[model samples]
Target: MCLYFLDCWLRTERYYELDDGDLALFESKREAFLKKYEKEIKAYRTERLIGSGTLRDYNFSSLPENILKNLDSYPPFNGYVYQNGILCARIKIEDKYFYLPPIYDEDCR
Candidate 1:
């Protein structure tokens, strides 16, 4: 099983507030986020790399509060953040997927 942090983009360096409607969007689509993104996010299962999967089957977690807060600073309502790596949480926007290299940050903590 995979652990995923469900998150959304923001516009002011604060946590983005999602109303019932926005929440519903996430709640309603388990396939979208878990689908795939070769552009960002690194996925691996066993010894092979996994590009996509089902969010329903994937585990969920809360993103770092600071990261969540930073997402709130973005402006575009339909864009993913992070310069060249996965942003941990947040939703996927493209129907296509991108493959990202595994993270090697010792300070991932």
Candidate 2:
């Protein structure tokens, strides 16, 4: 059972590959990405809380102080890293890791 579970886990797709230098570029623009998606992040969290019956109010302003603080610190995506021999940015949600697209500067294009 352990081996089967390990095999399934190993076979699961996790990382999204980035081009050379893309990881650094993504890191540099991380703040911008977070800011751009701030509304979406809040909506996602609100939906989660509502689904779990943890939040009775729909207004983001009404969220508990601790949850708000945690949301501020967490910022949806955790960080960028190399995993399974691939370079990618990791967005952690509910303990699951998902891919984050690179953020490019308009002038750099």
Candidate 3:
């Protein structure tokens, strides 16, 4: 199974920072992760992006405290980089689930 790193953006609290180490970690294993989860990621991302409309998706609780230390707010932000495109993870103040990106212009109805 491909391990996907979920960068969570909390709505009530800030909890993490995307730094060089994190970037390096993802970069190091990006190829392997992509090779294993390429198809799955692509398919899932397609649906999520469409479902979100114009809102961004996010995960609030998936972030570690260490990463959140740098933030000044309650909720945080997250990110996802796949073979298809870069996705930004966003969360609302009272929301639980992350809102995925909206569909591309061409994909809109």
Local error of candidate 3 at residue 47 (angstroms) = 8.1
- Please give me the total number of clashing residue pairs in predicted model 2: 0
TM-score (all chains, Cα) for each model: 0.17, 0.24, 0.20
lDDT of 3 by residue, 70-102 (tens): 535645333433323435455433344343333
Give the residue spans of candidate 3 off by over 4 A. 1-56, 73-80, 83-109
Worst 10 residues of 3 by lDDT: 47-56
Query: Per-residue lDDT of 35-65 in model 2, one digit per residue for the tens?
Result: 6434333333211121111111112333346
CA lDDT scores, all candidates in order: 0.31, 0.36, 0.39
Please report, as a residue range, the 10-residue window in candidate 2 with the lowest summed lDDT: 47-56
Q: Which candidate should be chosen as best, given TM-score against the real structure?
A: 2
The whole-model C-alpha lDDT of candidate 1 against the native structure comes to 0.31
Model 2 vs truth, CA RMSD: 17.7
Give the best candidate by lDDT: 3
Kindly indicate the candidate among 1 and 2 with the higher TM-score: 2
- Predicted candidate 1 versus true structure: per-residue lDDT over 1-109, tens digit per residue: 2334334542112122234654565578755534432212332221211212223211122334544455443222223334332322234323423222222223321
